[model samples]
Target: MRAFVAIVPPEPAHADLDAFVAPRRALDSPWRWTPAHLWHVTLAFMAEVPESGIDEMVEEVAVVADSCDPIPLRLKGAGMFPHAGDARVMWTDVRPTDPRGLGDLERLALRTRSACSRIGVPTAGGDYRPHLTLARSRRAVDATSWLDAMEAYSGPAWLAQEVTVFVSRANRSGRPHYEAEARLPLGRR
Candidate 1:
């Protein structure tokens, strides 16, 4: 199974972002925009794991979830991956609305990654910058204008209380669809 661990924003956050992006869709850029419903902050990307590993993966994630409390996060600002000049992906930055939430989020991410590692799940090792991907480009495109437009966007704050393991399935149109296989509640709430 192709799966990943992520934090799904609440409905209010999604609505706020969707409303903001609706007008910008007229830009007609060659970017393939991601559907708002599929937006998530990915913690660890486990490309392909055997179905037999699902049970162990869920248990590991639950342990990490139970160790942390809900995190308050907001979708704010915009940026591009690999720099703006040669950008491959466009995303909206996600950060804790509360001052202390930043450290909590960082720790949660680390704990989640550790849990995945303990279960022998291959993880994408590197710095984890929390962001919800907005779009992707097949080739490098200048995103200065798009970035500028999104600069003033600040969505509603929502509490992230669960870590979800999502199974990714490829569609006929080449776009990927994600289905939540397991949702482990933080602090067991």
Candidate 2:
């Protein structure tokens, strides 16, 4: 199965994001707005995972989770991927609420990626800049207006206490659908 590790924000946080995005959707924008259910902060994206490795992955990820403290984060600001002028993806920032939480979330991401690679599951290589993807455009275009509108947006804060390994499958519409395979609680292992 296609698998990835991610932080799925809790229900309350989802509600807050819904409230923030409702007004923006009403404007009939050009981008295909992502539904709230699809929101997540990916830690590692492994293209495929054979069944033999699931046990190793869970155990390894659990160890990483044990050492990292729970990170409190909020969704704020906006930016475009591959540059704003020819933007294909737009996302809302995932930021630590205070100085103490800084680097912790990124550490969690890096450790998890390393854990996966140690098990021979080659993960995507990139700098892990935390963000919840908001929407996608079919073609590259100037998304300056959308970026400007999202600049003032900030949602309610929430404690991210768990890391989940998700099985990603393609739906009929060619969009990715996620199902949590394991919920690895952070800390207190």
Candidate 3:
């Protein structure tokens, strides 16, 4: 099964992002708006895990969750991938601007990757860049007005206290549907 580990956004943050992106979606460009409930920050993509590996993943997540504290995330800025013209994924950027600044979450991902490797699961290909995926555009949106609107949007700080392992399955629409296979909650340290 296709799987990935991610930080589920808090409710307020999700709602805020939905409102922030609403105007941008009105632009005369092709873009698929992500469902509000599905917004999250991906930490690692564990591809094609065997059915037998599910238990191991749960165990690893428990260990990591127990060892770490929750991360306070701040949402800031909007950005496009592959430059402004030939864009593919549009997202809202997030960073740990607090004193600890996502340090705990970073360490947990490293640990999760090492643990997953033992079970023959491959992790994400590149360095972790935390962002909330807003849309997958069918065509490049080069509208200056839309870009300006996105640039002016901002959201408040939110808490990330749980790491969820999601099973991504393609639905009848061919769009991916994510189900939380398991979640590990991080209480205050």
Candidate 4:
């Protein structure tokens, strides 16, 4: 199964982003916007795992979650992968509102990835930048205008109290559908 660990933003935050993007959706572009229900800050992308490994993955993630405190995060600003001139992916930045939030999130991500590695799941290679992916373009698109439009967005802050392991399956339309397999609460929560 395809799986990943992520922090799903609360409904209010989603609503804030939805309101901001609603007006821009009509614009004709090569970008494929992500569905609102799929918005999440990915901590670790464990591309594939055997069904038997699911329990082990959950246990490892739960241990990491218990060791960390809840993080306060908000969606603000935007940028493109590679660059706006020839960008394939577009995302909104996820920032910690609290002074210690970034550090905490970083630690959480590191631990999550480590756990997946220990369980024999291959992890995504790259420095972890906390962001909620907004769209993807099949070919390089001029995302400068879209980036400019997203600059003014700053959504409501919410506590990320749990790390969820989501199973990804392709729908009939070939779009990925994420289902929460396990939700592990952080710290004492």
Which one wins on lDDT?
4
Q: Answer with 1 or 2, whichever has the higher TM-score.
A: 1
Candidate 3 Cα outliers beyond 4 Å, as residue runs: 141-145, 169-176, 187-189
- The TM-score that candidate 4 achieves is 0.94
In each prediction, how many residue pairs overlap at the backbone (N, C-alpha, C within less than 3 A)?
0, 0, 0, 0
In terms of TM-score, how similar is model 1 to the real structure?
A: 0.93
Superior candidate under lDDT, 1 versus 3? 1
> Quick one: RMSD of model 3?
2.5
Cα lDDT for residue 119, candidate 1: 79
TM-score of each: 0.93, 0.92, 0.87, 0.94
* Sort by TM-score, top down from the best: 4, 1, 2, 3
Model 2 deviation from the true structure expressed as Cα RMSD, one decimal place: 2.1
Task: Tell me, by TM-score, which candidate is best.
Answer: 4
Clashes of 2: 0
Candidate 2 wrong stretches, greater than 4 Å: 169-176
1-189: candidate 4 lDDT, tens digit per residue: 789999999899999998998777778888899989999999999778888898999999999999999999999999999899999999999999989999999999999999889879888869989999888999998889889988889999899999999987788999988789999999963
Q: Write the per-residue lDDT of candidate 2 for residues 3-104, one digit (tens) a residue.
A: 889999889888988888889888876688898998999999988888788788888898999888899998888999876889999898998898867599
Clashing residue pairs, candidate 2? none
